[model samples]
Every structure is written in structure tokens, then in C-alpha cells.
Target: MKRTFLLFTMLTTPSVSLADNAVNVVSWGGAYSQAQDDAFNTAFEAQTGISVNMVDADDPAVPLQAQILAGNVTTDVASLGYSDATRLCDENMLMLIDPATLRPAPDGTAAVDDFLPGGLSDCFVATDVYSTIIAYDESKFPENPPDSLADFFDTEGYPGRRGVLKEPRFTLEMALMADGVPAAQVYEILSTPEGLDRAFAKLDTIKDDAIFWEAGAQPPQLLVDGEVVMTQAYNGRIFNAAVDDGKPLKVIWDGQIYEMDGWVIPKDAPNPDDALAYVTFSTDAQALADFAMQISYGPPRKSAASLVGNYKDTDIPMTPNLPTTAQNMANALAFDNDFWVDNLAQLNERFAAWLAS
Candidate 1:
């Protein structure tokens, strides 16, 4: 394929200047970062003779902005969610990235045209599309497994502690979904006061029994410890737990909230040229497909989809595991970055107050 051919050529040619010899990347750590390390960083270093340093953060956008505001920018590139990437770009906190710089598809599709909707932007070129899904410990629900989003809210039907993310973004939308809102209408309803109240009210059904988790890794741990029977978790995390670690967990794809996450350069990165080089190489179709094989996240490039095959070191097909899979996406909500960009602060404050109450 042209993509792999491009990767092979680039790997052999080593065009990036080695003067800086390093690029610092901040991302959500765990299996996700490991995938990037395996598919991008390691290969990037070998390709350019430049060292790749990985930094962990709960949200890369936070530290990314802090570094810029402090006028001591250390990070070269960051993996950020769609809303953060959009907002940071609008605020001029991130460097302008031209889509033309990205590698085209093997079939010669332009990068701008090949990237999935919301994947290519002024300062962001998405790598993957992942989702927040409910994962239940199979040992906990042997008789009658919880299969739907509404089941997550049915405390009496499946009574046990529920693990929820400690944020309004996915949690509120999920609450609304479990309350019977259509996937397509979630953001529309969420944009209204009545819809907001309805979502919180649904959440009230299990708020007292909810165990909140801030990090992606916590949900699986919560299930393993038997602290929560089911949890809202990043789908990739649950996949890693079950396949990589032999955890007795099963993902509930209904009402899953999927979103794009990708690379952004800080406005004043320590190695701007090198950062651009790394981003370009890493977000290419071949690199994205390789990353997807390492984890369940769906690659954003249309060309990458065909390149994706089985999970790394396993016979399990990766397509079925991806959030973009037809079956998984049937009832999924494409997380509304526009809504979050506008209402995140207000919803966060409200969520905090609700938690206290």
C-alpha cells in the first residue's frame, strides 16, 4: 500500500533534523500512551534518530495551557480532546497546523478530505476516535447481565455501586441517554435547561451509590476490587483489562459517547520543527492503523480503516472493538464538542454543586 510504502521510505530516509534530538509529548497515560509509544514514538525515534519523551497527564490540555501561560513551554506536542483542541486553537494557545502538511492516503486522498468529520482542524489532526462505555464485571452479573444504558441507571434491578467519571461531559450525556433521550438529540436536549434538569434527576437515581473516578484507569480497578459492579470507562481501558489482563469485564456499547482525540503543538514549543515532524509522521494513515491495532480506538483516517486488522499479538479482529464499528455505533453518540466547548465551565460548576449536595 502507498501508506506503508510512505512509512518505509520515511523510516529509511530520516528527513527530520536531529539538532534538537528529542520531542516531549504529553498525553493521557496507560494503554493509550503505550499504544502511541509502540506505534509512533518508538518508530519515530528509529526513523529520525531523535529521542521521544512521554509525559503523563489526566488531561494534556491543562498542562499544555499552563506551560504556554507560564512562558516556559517545555512540551513539544500534546494529545487533546476535540473540544480542548478547538478551544485552545481559538484562544491562540496552540500553534497553527496546516492540514496540507499531513501525509495523504495511499490512494492519494488529501489529508483534509480523508480525515473523518471533526478530525482535521486548524490546529488539530485527529489520530483516533474512542468512546466512553459502560463495562460490567461478568462475575458480578452472571444471572442477568446489564445490557443497556438504562440498565446502568436501574439501581434496584441491578443494585450495586455504579462507577461514574468525575466530570459533567460524559456523565450528563449518559444520564440523559439512560433517561430515554435519542443519541442524535442528546446535545440538543443538553443545551436546554429542562434537559439539564432531567439528566441530573436521572443521575439522582444512583448518585448516592455512585463511585466517581477521575482517571481512565480507575474504572477497571474499581471493578476488580469489587467496589463497583459496573462503570463508565474509556472503551480502550476495558479492552486492555479483559484482553491484556484477563479481567472478567464486558463492554456495554449502547449509548456510548464517542469523540476524537489527536495531536496539538503548544504555541511556543521547544522544538517546533521537530514537533511538526513527529506529528506529521505519527498521524499518517499507517501510523494511525498501527496504533489502532495496539488498542481498540478507531483510527480517524478513512484509509487507515482498511489498513486496520487484528489486535496486536492477538487474533481478535480490531474492527469489532472500535467505537466506529457499525454495531457499536448504532446507538452511540458522537460526543458534541461544540456543546462542551460552550458549556463546559457552567456544567462543571453545576456538577460540583450537585456532588456536594
Candidate 2:
């Protein structure tokens, strides 16, 4: 752990030469950021001699968007969710990343060919597959723990506040699923005005009982603090909390909402050329595989799966803990990126109004 932190310091320290040579990176902090520090920052700097300056954000897109609009884009590369990456690219706020420029798998498979379907976007390069799932601290429900999405909304059944993301993306989808909508039919049902309304109406059942969270890191902390018995959390966050922090948190994979988190160079990035250099090194098959060892997220490249091992400092193999693991994925929902890309604004407007009211 000391070694990793020191590596991050060496790689991210803003020396006098940093601005000229470093690529500024913004990411969701805590263990996730540490994962990238191990998987990306140190290796990229060592190989290319380009320093990296790291920054944390609740969501990198928020500050990165501000940077682009202020016409003072400072960060060279910021990690983002798929829908956010697509939306920013749609708004022409991010640089187009051609797959041809990225390094492929060591087995001679093209990078584009090796990456999972829908993994490549015109402007974003995918890093890893992460998920939002139900996680509860075991101390509360030691006898009979929460297992499914239904339990998340079943305040009367579970009898505790449920911490959920304040945003509508995973929240709405999970609500609909809890209301008995099948995973495969979630987005289809959520497409209609009535469908969306039904999802919110389901949430209304537990509105008073819901302890909403805004940041990716909050759900785990909420569980630790006894704020919520069960919360919707990024699978990787909960895994780290359980394994590393020994928090006794347990993730229930039923009705899990899974998606990829990718990298995007903001439009007018201060260091466009070097930023691309960083992305090329960081998103390669081996790099992503190395990244998965630090965090439970699954590598986007199919070939990269062969290279994945156990979690950092543990014998617990990383694959079965990953959202994409067959055992865990049995009832997973592939978070519809296109659906969110199209309906995000409208739904979020509705969600905000609902929350305020």
C-alpha cells in the first residue's frame, strides 16, 4: 500500500516540468482512483516519460464540462460513464478517439476487435465494466440479508433506510426492476412516459425511506456509518470496502445494473497530443487487465480476461467478484447506454423536480 501511494505521488506530483509534459487526469477517487493509479498512471509515465497529474471529482464530466465551456480546459483526460462520454461527445465537448490509434491485445487482435461489443464509441475509449448493485453491511441483517432489488424498495420488509444514488440512471432502472419488471424488459418499459412514471411511482413507495446519495463513494460510507441498511453502490467500491477495509459489506448481484466507464479527452484539452498518448497506453489490453487486479471491474477487452488475477493483496480471485462474472451476472441488467443518452435530460429534469417536491 505504501508502495502504491508513493508511486502515485511520484507520478502525479506537479513538478515545474509537469504542465509541459504531464497529462492531467480527473477520476472518481478512493479505491477506484487508486486502481487507475496502479493500472495506468505509473506504467504510462514509466513507459512514455509523460508525467500525470491526478484530480478527483464526484463525476469527472461535471468539472470537465465546466472546463470546456469556460474555454479554459485544463484536464487532458477525464474518466466518465458511457452516457456522459457520449453526451459530451455529442455536444462536441470531447475529442474524437480513433480506435486505430490504440494498442491492441498482445495476441495480435486489433484493439477494436478485442474490445467488447458497444465498448467503442467515436469519442470515448472504454476502460472497465462496473456495476451498481445492492450492497448491505452484514451486521444489520446477519440472520437474513437483503438479496434482490425488491428488497431495496421494500422498506417495510427490510425495515431500514436504503441509500441510493440521487441520479436517475441506476436509481430509476432499479426501481422499475424492484416493481417486478424483468431485467431484459427494463429499458423497453422505461421508454414510455407511463413506464417512467411507474418507475418513479414505485420509488414513491419508498421515498420517505430512501437515503439518497450523490457521489459514487457515499453508499459504502453510508453503510459503514449505519445510515442505510442496504444501498445501491458501485460493485467495485463495495468489494474494496468489504475486502480491504473489512467492513462486512456484502453485495447482492440480483438485478445488478452494469455498464462501462471510459476515458475521454475534453475538447480543446491543454495537452491533446499527450492526452491521446496516455489513453493509448492506459486502455490497451494489458493495461486494462492490470487495472482489474486493483479493482473488481471487468476489462473491456475480451482477451484481457486471460491476464486478470486476484485482487490487490488478497487471494480472492477478481473474476467472480466482477459484475461480468457469470455467477454474478445471472440476473444483471445491461444498463442501456443509448436509452440514458437519449432520455437523460428529460428524465433527470423529472427526477429533480420529484426530489425537490
Candidate 3:
């Protein structure tokens, strides 16, 4: 376990006066919105003497794209999907913050090592880990539940209308898994032309059973309304919805497609140094844990998982209780940013054709 020494000077430099200059941050609004606003922003102001001007965006990509195209970067830091981060990096719109400068080490190894493998990019660093899984109404399937991706596609066995996202990433992966590829082999199969076609063909089998979801919040509602018996959903969103509505919903973690979201600084941000400090502060163990506990997103930092006690006793074993410990987070699949960046336009075209066909 590696730990970086906190840079005391960065907190005390006279020139870098911690005035109430509001650092801007943009994120998806919902439970995550309120959690970040109440927990992270409040603690940040107390510790750094810098206030935050928080902006909540329902569709983060549109506003972020608009800001970048208009040459006006309003947000100092933005929480974006891995695909979105890759797009921003390609567009030359992100600023890089040296990990060492963010938190100095006495021996001077980059603080990047403390992060999970594939969590850090040149311009972005992962902040949270989430999963897209099959969530079902437990009351309906009281005798037995679909436990894996294969079971999800077994319309005769499960016998209910299913909900799948309108996007390709998880849908393609789930299709491959149902077609009998192991979880680890999902992307490898999809990487090849034959495998990609096979996955799509398998998906076509259940196309009639699926009600495609367009928004993050919609899947849970569909589940609650009995529009679909089981649906693919973000684990945090589903968990929060279940808790709120007292719905007898349970997430099937087997064959779940996990994703990471991160904080990115714009290339020409006005307060680069302050931005680095803010990023570091946000990733600190306690703040990270509080953020995760308040909302259900898992923490990307190893230390952050230890700080949150509630996770240890959750319905699903908290990260620390698993076979792959938080420290060895390298095992998780790195979402293939390059593939998505290169193929999204073409893939979207093909997907539209498939959906209509």
C-alpha cells in the first residue's frame, strides 16, 4: 500500500491565497448531485478556504460539448463518463495535472501508483466505479431469480419483459456474455468482427422482450411501474431507487458491466494550480468515502474504501470484502476508450440500423 505525503506548502503559499474564489464543478444531478453538494463542497470550503460553484447537468455531455465548442470553459472540473473523457482528450480540450504536484511524495514517485490501474489518464483521473446490472422485482420472482447474463436472455425461463439500455457498451457486453463468453472474454469477443456480429445476433433474439431505456433515471421507474420485470441499470441508481420507493428490487451482480467516471480539468483552465489542489482534496480518503456512502457509487481510490464503514455491512460485500481487494483494483476491465473513440460514429450508425431492423 503506497501513500503520498501531503503537500503542506501547497496549502500555505502566500501567493496561492485561499480566498473564497469559487472553484466550479459540473456533475450529473440526482442523489449524486445532493451528496457532492452537501459533503464534498462543504468539506472543501472548510479545509481549503475556497468555495465551490457547483453546476448540475442532467445530460453532462451536451453542456460540456457546448462549452468546449463555444471556447468558454465555465466549469473548472467536470465529472464525465470514461467515453466522454476519451472524447474530451481527443478534442484537445483537457488540462493535465501532474500527479506528483497534486500530492507530493517524500521519495518523489508519482502519486498515480496509488490509484487503480487504468484509473489515471493524461488529463483525467477516475473518481468512482459503478456497474450496469440486471435489476429485478424480487416480489415477482420470489421462488428463484435470474442470477447471470445468460438467465437474463432466457425469456422462457424468466418469463417477463426485460429492459435494456439504448447504448452499445453494456448491451453488447451483456449480449456476448449471454452467448456463453466468460466475463473476462466479453471485450475480446466483441473486438473481432465475427464475435461482434454474434453478440448482435444474440441480442436480436431478445429485442422484442426489451424496452430500451434512454436516460439513467428511467430504468428504475420502468421497474417500479412494472413496465419491465427486469432491466439493466446502474447499481447505485437502482439501489437508491429501491431504498427510496421500498420496492422489492434486487441487483444481479453476476455478469455486470462495471464502468468508471472521473474528474477532468479543461486544457486552458484559468486556475490550474487551484484545480489540482481541488482534485487532490476531492480524492482524499475521507471525502471520497463520504461521497460514495452518501450516493452508492464505489470509490476508485483504495484508501477511500477503507474510510467508509457502512459499506462493510452492505447487502453486497463492500469492496474490501471481495476476492480482489481494493488495492488490486488493476483487475477490473479498463473501458476501451480507444475503441469507443475510433468507432463510436460508425458503431452508432450500425446500432441505429440494428435497432430499426
Candidate 4:
């Protein structure tokens, strides 16, 4: 395993130390955060002797921006979606992260060259690429399972409540796909007013049967509790349900929407130094690989791919389950950060009105 050397003073153990001596990381909770805690936080604290205060958020970007706008940024580091990172960077709410400062591949390859496209942006360094996929409890569909995005909206066919993310981003994209828009054209269509209306129309079909979820952990639990027979969820959450919790859940990759999630430092971070160190260490090749092994997300660094062997503590190879795998990408859509960055606020307002209607 490769480790990066950081020139920071350390403590032997990670106790609740002074706030200024610790790194406060905000991230999406559930299995994804657990994976980070296990693979990155534990190892980060051990190596640097700096305490890590990991906190949960439905979407870290929301509170991150809120805090920044309020001029009371308590968060040192945050895990954010690529679009959010880009948007925040544009608004000057985040610190600029130089790719050259990131730890490079073990073979001495430069960090800028080793990271995948869109992995190392001005304000974000991607740790993993995760997908939003449709997963269901197998027992709910003993005869015929939902295998495509269309089936998720087919209330009469699937015949149970569907789990929908409360946000407009993934929901809008999936709505278009279910309406027969090709993955390649989702953004082009969404770039227009008619396309947005059409996508919402498709969602209207399932709105009555849709059970909304805000947190990453809720989808799988909704499935286990029989509240939602089929639901849209982060692939890692469903992977954990099936592999770790031994739930009889199945993921449908047919219309998966994949995107990179990574680290960002608030411009007014209380502990900028430790935050940078944590981001640097956690996004290194070994750290990325370790996190991916614990979850199904694909590590963003090319070197991390070779380092990723199997799911932590299991013989299951991590590659096949990754969103970047060939079979999974067959009908996949890469979430369009550019489009979302431009129209999120407007669409979110529209979505709110639609929900209330």
C-alpha cells in the first residue's frame, strides 16, 4: 500500500482534541461514510496523529454552501458531488485545490496525469465514482423484477411504492430515461424547456406512488421494511445491503447515473492545514483503493484500479461491481455537471412546486 508523507504535528491517538487541532469532514452518511471512516479516517488519524471529526449530511454541499454564505464556515472539509464542487468553486465559496499538491501514483506519475477525467478539478479531488441505481428487494418481485428505468415508473406493473430521491437532479435525469430518452441525449433534451416539462410529466406518472428519501441510507431500509418494493439509491448503499447486511436486494444497472464524489475545503475553514492534509492523504492511490474495496464505487485514480483487489474482508472482486465497469456502463448516463450547475436552482424551484401540486 502507498502512503503519502505529510509534514504535520501528530498525536498518538484520536481523542476529542481541540477544535483547531482536528479536521472536520462532512459527508453523506450510511455505508458510504462508514467506508470512509474505516478506510480513510482511521488510517488518516493513525498516520498524522490529528483527530478527525466526521459528520453526516444528507448532501454535504447544501450545508457547506449555507455555512459559507452565512460567513460562519465551521466545516473544514466536505465530500461533494462534482457539480456542486464546480458550482461552489465558481461562486468562490471553496478554496482552490492545486492538483500538483495531491499525492501521485506509486510509480511517480503526476497526480494531474493519474486521476481520471473530471477527477481533479480546481476545487475537488475525487475519491470515488458512485452511481445512482434502481435496486429492489428480490422477494417483492419473485416472478418478474424491474430491470429498467421504465419499470420503476410503471406503478401498475411493479405494483408497489417506488423510492424517489427528494432532490431534482437524479430524479429529472431518470425521468427522461424512463420516458425513452437516450442516455447520450438526456442533457441535450434537458437543456430545453420542453424536455424539462416532458421529464416532469413522466415523473407525474409515479408521483402518487413515489415514496421520497433524502438520506443515502433510507432506500435500502425502505426496501427491507417493505415500504418501497423498488427504489432509486446510491449503488454502494444497495451493495452494502446485499453483501454486508445479507439482504436479498438486487441492483439494476440498466439506467444507472454515475458521478464523482470528492473532497473540498471551505474557503474559510477553521483548520485549513489539517483539512488539506486529510484531503491529500484520503485521495491518494492507496486510500482511494481502500475506500472502493469497502464500497462498490470506483476509485478515481488509474493507479488505484490495480491496487483494488476485493471487497474488504470478502473474496468478492470490486471491479465487476464498479459503475465504470463495461457491463454497468452499457446503458449508463454520466451525470451532467455543467447542465446541473447552470439550472439547479430554477429546476429545484419547479420541482418544489410540482411536489406541492
| TM-score for all models, in order of appearance | 0.83, 0.80, 0.82, 0.77
Query: Worst 10-residue stretch by lDDT in candidate 2?
Result: 1-10
lDDT of 1 by residue, 148-177 (tens): 999999989999999989999899999999
lDDT of 2 by residue, 99-126 (tens): 9998978988888898877689999888
- The C-alpha RMSD in Å for every predicted model, in order, reads 6.5, 4.6, 7.5, 5.8
lDDT of 3 by residue, 1-357 (tens): 111111112111112122345566767765676777765777777777777766667556666666667666555777888778877787888886566655422244355766666667777777777777778888788887777678888999888889988978778877887788876776777888998799889998889998999888888889889999988887877777776567788877667666778788876555666677788888765676777766667776665656664542355444532212343232334456666767678778888899999
Q: Which is superior by lDDT, 1 or 3?
A: 1
Cα lDDT for residue 235, candidate 2: 88
Instruction: Score residue 111 of candidate 1 by CA lDDT.
Output: 94
Worst 10 residues of 4 by lDDT: 4-13
- In candidate 1, which residue ranges exceed 4 Å CA deviation? 1-22, 45-59, 70-74, 268-271
Residue 266, model 2, lDDT? 84
TM-score winner:
1
What lDDT score is found at residue 7 in candidate 4? 18
Kindly report which residue pairs in candidate 3 clash with one another. Answer: 94-267, 95-266, 95-267
Compared to the true structure, candidate 3 yields what TM-score? 0.82
Query: How many clashes (backbone N, Cα, C below 3 Å) per candidate?
Result: 0, 0, 3, 0
Clash pairs detected, candidate 2: none
The better candidate by lDDT, 1 or 2, is: 1
